[model samples]
Target: INIIMDTLAGLAFAGEAALSRYMLEKPIPKDEQLISEDMWASILINGSVAALASLFFLNYAPIRELFSRGMPIESEKAEAIFLTAFFGFFVFMHAFNTFNARTQGLNLFEHILENKLFLGIIFLIFTVQTTFIYIGGDVLRTVPLEPMEWLYMVMFALVLIPVDLVRKWVRNVWFGNPVQTRVNQ
Candidate 1:
């Protein structure tokens, strides 16, 4: 998780342009924590969503059949293919969550392309992950997935986009900007 999610995601986040509004806010006091309550809220909620999805996918039944295409699930090759899909799903899920993790704002794509390095890294992450699914073969215990299967996993993982967006909108409307509050701890 750390290597796959953090390296590229962190780079993308680190590339975000600092808002000029940051200059207007009062300087954080020494004793106060940098992360605010709003951040904690988004973090906990989105993180929980990802964790739950992971727990949900760690199974072997109907889902495996969907990926099995035709091979008997009991066969070693079918098991490898199942494992491959499972791993691929896990990677793509985190990749989708990366967009959510980068912001507390309502617009997940706001100014995303403005950061060229960030965009490049995101594209790179996707490309490399896809390549891994194909070339990874025996060593990585992966098999190339069909296009529709790839789409299925991505579409399912993308559930986080709306979920996080709603969470952000609700927080923005009912709660307010996270940066306005302070965490003394």
Candidate 2:
């Protein structure tokens, strides 16, 4: 089941890559000139390289142990499946996110800075909360693992998956209409 899911995720990533390429090759209006072949190529190459480096780094004992977190033995097959799905989703997410920002008329630098700040704050909050919970008391004993975490994660991902739809909606309602907002200089 996990392998099948992982394969599906990989296929999805491949589809996203193809879609990005297609978007790059198409003509973009002056107001929506964000998707470019150079940008897509850079993203694709860098993402693939990062994934490869992560896979190689995971072989190191320290890195492996860090991820293991003193947990008991799990199936190696499951680990591979998890890793595959992780990378696949990561690639697709990055592609979709950049595509969304481009289609939104957001400058790359500003968009990245904003997103990094948001992610950093979320990471800090989660880290501090988890640390305090562990230090202050054994909350893990009282709170059993719930499927809600998985559900929330899935929902979070699904929200991003509609980037193209949102772009189309925005264009149709806001920009794609006959009304031009520019002033003649």
Candidate 3:
């Protein structure tokens, strides 16, 4: 599963087109660090936010009951709703990382729609992952989740975007703005 996810990620990241911001930024020197401090800020902050949110969904009661399907909750059932939510978001957070990884800076949505391949790959990831929850049954250890469960999960994972935006804003506040040479200005 991890391999599959990484492959999808590679495809999504590679397909992103050059954005206008690319024109404004100065080129990196040959000896510069591969990952900048800003990138690390985003990596730590957004990744922590997503992981914490997934753990929250795992413990949230309403979600547990919603996915439980009348199975006795305290009985340590294998297909419990809370567990289901965890698995869904496990796949979802990885699926959604495409958005977080899309940008060198914070404006992830800039020129977003211009890349049809990225959009399609994301669609494939989400659609297939959800479908697996329904059809995977014993192999996937998933109980069928209602559509509302899915909506809640997707919206829940969507919080990564706002969390990242705030992370970027805070980065600018403490570390100063990104050094973009305003070339062709």
Best by TM-score: 1
Off by over 4 Å in 1: 179-185
Candidates' TM-scores?
0.87, 0.28, 0.82
Q: What is the C-alpha lDDT of each candidate?
A: 0.76, 0.39, 0.72
* lDDT per residue (tens digit) for residues 88-128 in model 2: 33333443344343322333233344344344433443344
* Candidates 1 and 3, the one with greater TM-score: 1
TM-score, candidate 1, is 0.87
Error of 2 at 101 (Å): 6.2
Q: In candidate 2, how many clashes are counted? A: 0
Candidate 3 has an lDDT of: 0.72
Each candidate structure's count of clashing pairs = 0, 0, 0
Question: Highest lDDT, which number?
Answer: 1
RMSD of 1: 3.2
Give me the displacement of residue 107 in model 2, in angstroms: 4.8
lDDT computed for candidate 1: 0.76
